[model samples]
Target: MPFEAEEIRIDLMCRIAEDGHWHGTLGLNVDAQALWRLGLHPDQPTSVVNGPSPPAWWHTAGERYASRHAVRRRHDGR
Candidate 1:
């Protein structure tokens, strides 16, 4: 099968931990820079043999939570 790639955005509810790590519910217009730093960049493909599972601290909680805030916004709606 043939696949075509395109740019996309991601969103997340993020927080910095005391240990200097991050934790939060992942939504999806997540900054490419942030994603790249976190090892979650879509442009760079990865596999389980060499990479870890998506961080447990950040994940989709459920259908309802995911549905609520997984979008990219140009302006702050916070």
Candidate 2:
């Protein structure tokens, strides 16, 4: 994801729900101790539930819909 804070990064463990739909988000790595002490390697899944990134078209469509609707989910997804 492109943002003003380029140094900030997060690793989102993506997964598909039971509704036969895929959902996942992979962000840039921005950590030092997590890598050194925790050994959380960048660009690597720590578990077998590794999922791929969503297609670009999916993102574009989402953006379009959200823009037209002007709706956003809260932090708790509500």
How many residue pairs clash per model? 7, 0
> Residue 44: error of model 1 in Å?
1.4
Clash pairs (backbone) in predicted model 1: 9-29, 10-28, 10-29, 10-30, 11-28, 11-29, 11-30
Best by TM-score: 2
Tens digits of per-residue lDDT for model 1, 1-78: 011133334466878868786766655444565455446667766541233445454464544577897776543333
- Model 2: CA > 4 A from native: 1-49, 72-78
Off by over 4 Å in 1: 1-28, 47-78
Candidate 1 steric clashes: 7
TM-score for all predictions? 0.25, 0.28
lDDT of 1: 0.51
Clashing pairs in 2: none
Candidate lDDT values, in order: 0.51, 0.57
Q: Tens digit of lDDT per residue, candidate 2, span 1-78?
A: 322255457787777778766767667865543343333456455653233445698789888988889565433345
